[model samples]
Target: MIEDRYSTASTLYPYCRVSDQDAEPRRHPVVIVGAGPVGLALALDLGQRGTPTLVLDDHEGPGAGSKAICFAKRTLDIAHRLGAAKKMVEKGVVWNVGRVFYGGEQLFEFNLLPESGHRHPAFINLQQPYFEQYLIECIRVEQSKGTPIEIRGRNQVTALTDKGDFVALEVDTPEGTYKIEAEFVVACDGARSPTRDMMGLSFDGRVFEDNFLIADVRMEAELPTERWFWFHPTFAPNVQSTLLHKQPDDIWRIDFQLGWDIDRDKELDPSRICSRVDALLSSQTGDVPDYELHWTSIYTFQCRRMQEFRKGRIFFAGDSAHQVSPFGARGANSGVQDAENLAWKLDLVLKGLAPSALLDSYSSERTFGADENILNSSRATDFMTPKSKAATIFRDAALDLARDHAFARTIINSGRLSVPCVYDGHAHFVQDALTNGPEVTRPGAPCPDAPVEGGFLLDNLKGNFTVLAIGFDCSKLKLIDGVAVDVLCIHKPSEYLQERYLGGGKSAVYLIRPDQHVVGRWPEFSEDKIRAALLTALGKEPI
Candidate 1:
């Protein structure tokens, strides 16, 4: 087993007792519980805005295993903004093609990176430990740059009390227990969140009876760095489905679907796992490659989420707020987006620039996102593991038809891989009344990335409210106070940009939020209308 390969020492944060003469319960602007990807990303996002953030995690360092392998384009964009994407991309494996097979017959394949003009690719595969380690490094760099982000490892929040304006917390550390208070508390702790339990919140959704065996194997083999999925492959008997994803360090993530009534212990035995791996590899290549087990985990799929993400002064992000099956890679990516969504709103609220009501938009928008992920994940799970004979018949028929017809291939749901959620009907988004711009750049959608002068459009719109003017003058527009608007004038539009954005005409203006979601767009620039849209996007005005 590859146990020591990913071990790292934790960085300690000085703790002071509440009873100490000089040490009163230290009050922070924001206290984030759980220093995983979501919490760390939130800290980086807030820190970039010069917001003071404290992140506490019970673990001494990053967790072991390649828990989340696929990082999506939207997540890489967020990571790029946080100053960690370059490292992640450098240390990860990038793949865009996924091939599906049904009982040794290649059904069809799809490409995720069919378009250009975007900086990052469709997806990159890296171990979760590496992901977390890079985020921790980013946080430290931000702290050194005077961002005031403190990450305390091995510090667990044992108790929490919401006191209206602020949330009080009791933290347990190696030294002793201490108390602290924060204007806001973000729970990024995983599914079985202590913070969620402490708040008496419950998640509601379906937990699939099917169990999956996730095995991480390191081998010196010449397998393509693409996703390979199988339905009833001849390698393993009684196995309904299998998924294989290649990660960095020659580690391959293999998932096998084990039906409901499985002996958990027997299934996880090393010998049994090795035998299954040997059979799978032999079936694929007609020869078994030398390999060694790294990590193994057995998990049941769950598509669940709390009714509301925000509860009084505390907010839940990531898996704590919602969870879905790993099939779509929605769990981590959605969590990262959740952090991005909340960080900007929380920063504004902390700086007294926006009301607490602005935070409500986070709950509403992410709840919408979580619901969409749940629906897609549940459907994929249902297709992968049919509960009834009729469902199985339909699934097999679709697979059979996929091999012959292109139209039938669209119905095949190996997993409708996660895509960014567009907050289409969100209260904060102001729809464009003008029919000049492309529908792809409609309000509430993630600003369609396009090539601009010297770099991409999204690179220029980072970290602030952006007023993007394409073939138009927006110099006369005035924005609300405290809202920093970066006016990006695209003098010469690329073909991709023209097609995806300036469709009807070249003259268009887009008002984008800090999170890069389009708030409003217009054919002609209007200072009054742009200002009103900004206010609406920030929850300061009614749509």
Candidate 2:
């Protein structure tokens, strides 16, 4: 038996537990293993949906390292949904353009605004420490709202036992061994997840054959106006290279490649590392200031994803599920997507509105996404950090080609960083049926943004299910009780979405899910079809 003072926002809620003499017994609804951004995001999502979740972490406090400086538009979208995007955007640096340089010459520059259609809030460069703090604050506010979100810092889960109906877990805190039971569990414990190991799931993937020195240092001198990336030649022969990015706090994140075969003990010496950085910077500028090194560590790139995201009632999110190279900010962004995808499904399942099969789709949809991001990120890393002699020569040749061809230059230089991943392959949605409705419409596709009387069409469609009315009269459709769907009459959409969705001059209607993903669309308004798709998704029987 063990005892601890579990306090609420106003006061700590007392929690007591008893363990079996020889074996473990069943504690909380969902016990999350890691307290990183992924874990914290899941906690906030679950908490807001009125689900009980316990987040546990081995770390004493929040991590204060400069890792994952890039945030994709999709991640920013998730943050907005979580009610923290505005604050994050205010605190972070908004970067729409980035520069890639080779041998003191500009290879190519890519701008995101044109590609993404507008100031996408697409990608921002920010400190990971501050972002984590923002999430912690959001969790605290939710806790204060009477939706209990238990965050156990300095507590580690030692063992887990699955007993069919529920899961039993043993956690070791400063006091002693403790046990808790929950209906489900989510393991976001990161790359070295003990929860994954305990569940006996295979993490099948590859660890690259090169090490990189990661450093966060305050810039000592005037920096370039753009987000600069460099591939330079050093005093050492044709060996490893560097990757650098300027962060929010006047700090620069620098990564120097150490050859794969170098000795770990000799390679990780901090003084030697700093000397190399100074040498590289000195060649670009006459003098550089002495920098205060915030953190230094030797990390190798790894491209590995878990075979499955769930082991019984225990689900995995973040690094526990998939890990990609930090190239193009895919690692953290994908993990945030995992939390967003899982949160709504988990909420629906708990509320008994959907079948358990919907939960299975979470892994299928996200794992497919993980594979895509991992493949793209791995290719980017390979291009950036070439190991073999033949590959290096090929990479250099490609860069030379990029310098000559305008389109080729953009292709090689533009970091194809965050494409909004589609869940089309997942079998949950009624895809084929909706595709046959209109020429411009497609089933299971993202709702096309159109011009309406409101701010943006999407802005007004928030909160509940929305049914857009096209050329057909909406008054003809019969209303159903307790069903929430908005009818927006669009006689002239061309006046609004110029050159976008309505450019083809066709009237269309759409049914949007609460999460803002399109469920179905049609050229004509049909009361039966809209209600049917809604009932199917919401698990309500047809009237």
Candidate 3:
């Protein structure tokens, strides 16, 4: 039997009344507007840091349908930091290879992770509901250990006022209404954000005219666990494109591009949907396979984002801050990264360790990420749904050449699958001193994971602010900018660690941020340079 994990009938967090609902407006260090993946992840980060945080959600539990099925490696790494990757990784369908086809001809197949030493696979396919469920469960466990995290279900934020120093919020509940205040408000509400509407803000970008028929089917079939994207498939000539993905359990996700002028109601009919699925199956197995429809929906996407993610005391993350086509699996993956980036900065600002200006970097850095996702998603959408005659001709020509030439294979854009955005040039940019080091671990780039003697390199750099020494000794430096830093000195580095961190040099030092991004790197240990980099990262002056 197929289970609907996204159904609204499930009440993971039941309605509950607290002192804040009955008394004067209660204040918190941080208040999250939505309890989706982004909000829950942000709460996990802040709460684990001992920050008083609360989450407000209109629904009782996970939403209906398996919305996002692709979770990237960087996302898993962030989840590992928040203590919620085990269940997700275990329950998800892990895959690293992908095959692209053009109308009965195989163009090429590629593996996202060709090298070893990484802790997680390239990507995993898990329903969005399961993703949220694991996070919510982690929150419950953290609460047991005295993490000041509170989640109120059926509580909707109706209005909010930014008072400069803080923000006042009005929330409606099943019973009545109440008011609350917070030093910071994070909007993780989905694309049609009520918080954005309340703030009188909107996205600025292009909205393509195309519809996708998404069907989640439950059936027993023998199919390889890999991503299969087809352009101009032979099975259904009427369909422009098709995507097949393996989700957890026996369910499979299939997406059909129905173009701009599609009959929504007629296409959603069970017979019509079944026929489409049967056609796809007949091509693969030469027979119609029996299957049950677990869920079905039609979606239209837009590639857009706010000019700025932060405005006053209220901040935005996830879909509320940006919206991109679902072609690249960038929507949820990028949102999780946004939560990670904002959580650390907010922690520092609320604790008075760094200037409030540090928060500005969050906007600048994430907008950089949002723009990358938008450009890639827009390009993928255009490639899939050609608008001009020249575009179609070019795409077809590239596909024809892909059957023989490898260069043409690179030209086909079937959703450049999500990868960690290497923020090489963005605000709070720090110059790199280890010029000979691997470019993959340069400043503003996510730390590459490598196997070490103890476990993994990422596991060793365990702190909001970490000073990682690969081959030199730096036990004397403990704190930077008056904040404690997790200084990890490894003199006897393994080959993997030396290759990733030190590159061709004998030794190197790196200052990494709370989100595990390298703030700066040097060939030798220098206290003054590290201090200056830390200050620069925090948007403050060097001592």
Q: Which ranges of candidate 2 are over 4 A from the true structure?
A: 1-27, 114-120, 232-239, 387-390, 410-415, 432-442, 445-505, 535-543
Model 3: CA > 4 A from native: 1-9
Cα lDDT of model 2 by residue, 1-543, tens digit: 222222112211122322322345445667888777788888888888777888877654555555677887767666666776777888787766677767667777766563333224667888766677788888878878887687876577888888887888888765677677788888998877788888778898988887877877777557663566666544333445566677777777777767677777776677877776777667668776778776778888789998878777989988888998887788888898888778877776776766676778678878988998888888877877776789878788877877667755654522457665665744644443433343233544544444465445655544356776655457533234454456666555544343434334365666766555667665566777777777665545546
Model 1 Cα lDDT, one tens digit per residue, 505-528 = 857888889999999988888877
Give the lowest summed-lDDT range of ten residues in model 1: 1-10
> lDDT of each model, Cα atoms only?
0.86, 0.69, 0.88
Please provide, for model 3 over 339-423, each residue's C-alpha lDDT reduced to its tens digit, 9 standing for 90 to 100. 9999989998999998999898889889999999999999999999998999999999999998899999899998887887888
- Relative to the true structure, candidate 1 has a C-alpha RMSD (angstroms) of 3.0
Instruction: Order the candidates by lDDT, highest first.
Output: 3, 1, 2
Q: Candidate 2: deviation at residue 94, Å?
A: 1.8
lDDT of 1: 0.86
Higher-TM-score candidate of 1 and 2: 1
